[model samples]
Target: MEIDQAGKTNGQQPLFPTPSSTPPPPPPPPQISLSLKRLLTIVNCLLLCLGNAGGPIIVRIYFLHGGHRQWLSAWLETAGWPLLLFPLSLSFLYRRRSNPSAPAVLITPRLILASAFIGLLTGVDDYLYAYGLDFLPVSTSAVLIATQLAFTALFAYFIVRQRFTPYSINAVALLTVGAAILAMHASSDRPAGVSVGGYWKGFVLTLGAAALYGLVLPLVELTYSKAGQPVTYTLVMEMQLVIGFFATAFSTVGMIINKDFQALTREAANFGLGETKYYLVLSFAAILWQCFFLGAVGVISCVNTLLAGILIAVFIPMVEVLAVVFLHENFSIEKGMALVLCLWGLASYSYGEYREAKEKKEQIASPQVQTSAV
Candidate 1:
């Protein structure tokens, strides 16, 4: 018999006696390489860039080509959520390969609830955005969307304790100015027949969408932090899937109430772009907006919400280009100057991020070098 650390008697003596109360330290969190993180970040950034550039253009085309139902357009944003299953299936395959006994689902009930709440908010944002698009030009809406970065920063600071550098501040200021530039002459670039009140309404709605979405981003980051389960990329995708389903459901309810579903067939039949093109545009909207959201969450999982917002703000200028080339929009001198300022701000932010990363890498290397010298 031996006395254990807890003052309990052990009936059987062991070859090596250890104190029962001396428990082993918990396992450390998994360590991923910075290079791998950067790679994933780049891939997600590319996705965000593509979706940001193409998604809005596709949706704008719907309105320009005779789409009149805002709820229908909003529905399309999350309707393509099922497309995430392809990648999720791949993730499932890898998980089973790595560990045959792994559970079918990684996300917990808590994460699902959080994701659903956020998805509801996303649904509201979707409607606001779609309604805004019905009246505003894509370029103007995009510049307004750029203001999301400012809101994202403000919310992120409080939500996730995000710290900003001077460069990010400068970027925010420049983009704020760019958005304000449009406000100065609100009526100057109004589409042919959009009424003064209607344009202002769109402006306010889009700004609301931007601010709401800004809050949404930080909330998402907070969810990731609080999710009881380890937040893997696959789990992040699953959460996104849940979010999309709820958002689509939210819009579906609106579509029912507004009779947008009944109007869909009629609108499709008489669309300016032809019935074939009308359906095609809807299909594209579904796919493109899914791309936008998946990319957004992917970026958040890889890094933080701030970077995701920054990436979005950086590429809005590209939307202006697409608006001019494909939609034949009027890109005025004011927008051109705004474009330059936006680019300049993005450049500053990028340089700052690069410097910070470099400093961190050097700091890590110095410790290893000192150890090797010893």
Candidate 2:
């Protein structure tokens, strides 16, 4: 009843068809392209955008509460906050040093010099950003800052020999559209906004800073990729921080030189150290954030690390809303819209990255399986 054994019946080859199709070659695995990867890189840049926006938002809150020019000066003015980062970073460095695989020799002067350069770059980047805030809205500044993604891609293409894809171009278009929307909203209105303390000169300077910061990543990679182990990377960063702190302090020397030392001290006491203490707390928070950032980058790819900034942006508006409801502050709808755009952009960016990653994982696993089967 099953079929004639080893004999043709009605010209049939076999009852199971003799695996004629060869399982259709497993349907040929899914294909990915260079363009898709470029999209992911853009998504990472979106994360950086959110981070850029968050800074101004923080500064704005301070400004609303009668804190003037604090973001730049607060860290140095407080002893506790600056020291916090040093210890945390040092702890990380020590852990790396203690690893059995780490070399026995101490870090060299050449490494320190390289690290200092990075620090200087970082310090200048901050100053430039602060300068831009003097002329632009928090929302607009965030959009403008998104340009760094473009810069990052440009650097990657030219320096790292990374290729760009069509997806990257599309991602750039989305970011640009969103940024333009945000920028239009920012420039359209001004109510109780801080007056520009300077002129076009300030704007130009800030733009320069953004460009320089955009350059820092490549520079760091170029210098340290040769000798930097993961632990040594931390040491490099620490060196940069040390140098940046001093450099910034030197620039602000005018604050010390021009102001009456005795009168300023008296005024500081009258205002009470409570406000200064607030700066100290924020500075510590900044340091903690930096640690978190570095850890995130270390554990995940740089793309993921950058995209995580959207989480920060998402939180900013929520915090602002809570302040308005509980603390009784007036709210601006414009700020709300800007936040919404940033969140949406972030979501799109993240989805694109996830899809790309999932595709890559499948692609890698499939080859191995095929080879084993063969």
Candidate 3:
């Protein structure tokens, strides 16, 4: 009877294991909540805006207070970039000890060389920007920098294969028009201390700075995409560290060659704000500029180069407002129009993003629904 019962149970078992013996399905992969991601993006954008706006203001204040140390300021700003090293070091140690087989943060010498080359360009870019700001009002400099958005869009299209929807086209067009208006009207409201010749020099230099930075943004995107591995925040920061190291090295050489380092002591002693405040201003400016650099790069990693450029462009008006309040610069009618147009372009881009996201969600959901129905 027992053998008969065992045979009956075995027959019932069939070819598959019983439910109790079957293994459970694996857990779903971890993911950041959509809302959290959006919130983080917003926070990063705000920080980027604030840092960009404030860095210039601090430098302007230094100059306003009779600080003629252009090279010093530029060097300090580039020098602070090494602050990224601490985090990068931690990442390396963690990866080595915890995940011995994981890919190194930036292992290839060719990649390092490429990043350093970009950093050298960035160092030159920073000096030009500083040279411009030394001669131009903060408001005018901000306007010129806005031109970077157009250049960034152009480069992104060619280099990254970023597709431009009609909305993005409209955004780019409007932004360009607004910048042109600003440039045309730029001569009308020269700051009290600046001369016509200086203004033009500043204008040209600032535009050059913008163009170089535009190239930098797209090239960064290209480098990461070509990395042959998935890019992460750690990798992004590591790239920044490499770039910063090279940039700082270049600037340090410039400082030494120009004897800017030798003049630093005398400049500090003769500073209008006194020696301590003068050093403080330089320190703060350097740190703030690094913050802006990091924030911009972070934004690029999180979104795209075009979006990062747009965010910077959008904040130009805020920088203008700040210039008006603190630096006593003019806010002409053209500048007002520029601000309005920037807002409009931002809205259009945002709407396009929303539509694209919606379509993607629908596409993903449709497949699931069809499978369930079947």
- Highest lDDT scorer: 1
Candidate No. with top TM-score: 1
Local accuracy of candidate 2 as per-residue lDDT tens digits, 306-374: 333233333444444544564344456655665576566556666666778799999999999999999
What would the TM-scores of all predictions be?
A: 0.90, 0.60, 0.85
Error of 1 at 243 (Å): 0.9
Better of 1 and 2 by lDDT: 1
Taking the tens digit of each residue's C-alpha lDDT, what string does model 1 give over 33-76?
87887887788888789888988999999998888899998999
Model 3 segments beyond 4 Å from truth?
1-40, 89-107
> How large is the C-alpha RMSD of every model relative to the true structure?
3.5, 15.6, 7.5
lDDT of each: 0.87, 0.49, 0.82
Better of 1 and 3 by TM-score: 1
lDDT for each residue of candidate 3 in 1-374, tens digit (9 for 90 to 100): 22243334434543445455767875542465678667757766876887788888999888888887667667766677778878778878887897676565654676788789999999899888888888888887888899999889888989898888888888888888888888786776566778889888888998999999999999998888887755666767778778878887888887888898888889889888899999899989888888787878778777788888988888888888888899788778888998999899899989988888899999999999999999
Clashes (backbone N, CA, C under 3 Å), per candidate, total: 0, 2, 0
Task: Please report how far candidate 1 places residue 338 from its true position, in Å.
Answer: 2.0
Checking candidate 1 for backbone clashes, the offending pairs are none
lDDT score, residue 184, model 1?
60
